[model samples]
Target: MLLVLAATGALRGVLDLRTPLVVTILANLLNIALNLLLVHGFDLGIGGSAAGTAIAQWAAALCLVAVVLRRARAAGSSGRPDVAGVVAAARQGVPLLARTATLRAALLLGTAVAATFGDAPLAAHQIATSLVSFLAFALDAVAIAGQTLTGRTLGAGDAEGTRALTRRMIVWGLGTGVVAAVLLLVLAPFVGGWFTPDATVHDALVPALVVVALVQPISGVVFVLDGVLIGAGDGVYLAWAGLAVLVAYAPLALLAGSLGAGLAWLWAAYGVFQLARLVTLWLRQRGDAWLVLGA
Candidate 1:
């Protein structure tokens, strides 16, 4: 998992994610083959599955490293790693790390709040949360495009291009969100049945899923703007924005926990959080504040 993460991050930095994406696909394919070969052919059970996964992960990492090196060579860049560059990279990444950590903390807190509601609500919440997470991949594809394009356009001093790209990407994000929302609503009946036999769990999941669907467009706008901010080198403000969101989200989350609010309310807490993010990001984008014109 760590290896894949590192490789993916490295690939994202250079806007060369195809290599890592392919690596992931191939690794998972290899994992399946190894699981069948080991677990079935060798008659090893769960241990074989674990070993297969470990082997696939390491192989994928190595493949990514080779691709990175080859790409560097082909690009004719001085292909050497240095401690100073590593330190500088880590220094630059601190704000992003803080942003990610705090966001994840909020998610975990939501889960804890759901757990207080009883087993059924907690189970339903997990399913709904998982649904949101899976849909996020689709939305993030637009954000990633925004990030790469924003960085390159800013680097080239094309402020107009940067603005246009941000606008277009935000539209794409919203469109993606709308699609996710429709899919979620359409799948509500069948999805709940696929997950569990408990009628209560299924019933609880349906409404929460609606809430999740309702928030998709909001989440979409927030995510794309987040990428634009990061790409424009507004990490400090982004970190501050994340902190402000934490403050806003905490009260609602706490209230939900204390009152044992339904799963929809907990997800609504997330909506508040995403709404705050949209405001923060829009403020930055409204002016030249995030427009670091050169380098």
Candidate 2:
């Protein structure tokens, strides 16, 4: 993840879009190949899966390092790696990591709460979550774009530009969410069936899948807002915002009577959390006049 972030930062500073795009494609291809060989050819199972992923990551890191070194050589630079730049990036990243970890833990807690209902509910929740994961992949790309744009804008001392980008992202995000929701609603039953042959699990999962699908876009917006805030170096706010969301989970879960109810409440809470982040980020961006001051 650090290498990817470094590569992105470097690309933003020095390289063209095509270079990073090509590198990302190559890295993903290599990762897929490693996964295939380790999981299928060697039957290494989960351990092989881990090894494959680690190897692929190292390969990408090497590639990124080579790119950085080449850039340095082309510039006739003799100094060490950009320690200060890296440290600044790390400072911003640490809180984002904390926020992510806290959010993930809350998700786990939600799953555990669902499990308390019984095996059927647990299975349904897992299936719904898996579907949500698939939806998130596409949304994640948008979030990454928001992060990159936000960071670049802030770095350039263009607060107005950053605000514009954030608004555009949110608008597009809402539209994307509605479309994804509609598709999920239509496909929920079929998607649910693919997960299991069990009728009870399928029945319980279909509605949950629809709910997740409809709300996925909202979740995507939240994720994008998070990226924007983190890119702006608002780590403290990110941590506090994540903590607020985490705090909401238990009470909401306690109020839920059934697995579906719990999932619904969870999704609603997620949307509220994300909207709150958008509001907070907008306010912070507006209030911080220094952020717009010339470099």
Candidate 3:
């Protein structure tokens, strides 16, 4: 999985976004076909679903690596590995690893808390979160753009250009998010039906979906600023900020669970998590410390 991500990032680093995008789309299509074949044709059930996904991801990674190597060869890039450069890159990635770890931990906490509310709430939580993830992936395109563009501009030492790019990306993120929210709102009542036939889960999910819709704009800002900081090589601050947001979120999630609140309140707690991230990133963006002027 990490290899898949690394290959995708490497492609993106060279501004070859279309390759990864096309590769991912094809991989997803292959994944669906394999899942049907393995699960239904082979009768492997849930394990087959997992296997299909793994196979698709591995295929995607290998395809991407081949493309990258082909490009490298075409560019006449042939040399011994730079051990020192590799070490520096690894060091720079550590804080990002930490940040991602903590953020995932918080997500796990939310899932755990949701489970305490019984099967219906847990199912509803799952549906709502799946939608959130789907929307996030779409919105994250803006963040990816921010990451690529911000790095290029800052690497060129164009401070004003970086700021202008940042502003433009933020606005784009917010606008995309608003459109998503509206669509989600319009679809909330019917979406759960597509996922499950259980009336209890379906009804319980509506408010949760509403909560998810309401948080989209906040999510937009959080994702964009996060990418901007990452592009600026400000991962250390991101690591700490992620920790702080997790700390702030745990209690709220726990409180909602203990109060026997439904899925919506639990999701509201997640909103607080996004809001905390927006606050930290907003503050960081307001300063020039992350504006390192060179590659």
Q: CA lDDT of each candidate?
A: 0.87, 0.71, 0.92
Instruction: Give the Cα error of residue 285 in candidate 2, in Å.
Output: 4.7
Residue-by-residue lDDT tens digits, candidate 2, 12-129:
5552456767777887888888889999999999888888778877777777768877887888987486799769778867877888887787668768777776788788888877
Q: Write the per-residue lDDT of candidate 1 for residues 134-236, one digit (tens) a residue.
A: 8887798888878878888999899999999999998999998899889988998779888899999998898889888889998898889988888887888
Which portions of model 1 miss their true places by more than 4 Å?
1-3
Q: Is candidate 1 or candidate 2 better by lDDT?
A: 1
Q: Enumerate residue pairs that collide in model 2.
A: none
- Writing each residue's lDDT as its tens digit, candidate 3 over 102-156 gives 8889889999999999999999998988898899999999999999988899999
Clashes of each: 0, 0, 0
Residue 45 deviation, candidate 3, in Å?
Answer: 7.5
The alpha-carbon lDDT assigned to residue 101 of candidate 2 equals: 85
What is the overall TM-score of model 3 with all chains considered together?
0.91
Model 1 poorest 10 in a row by lDDT: 2-11
Candidate 3 deviant stretches above 4 angstroms? 30-59
Q: RMSD of model 3, in Å?
A: 2.3
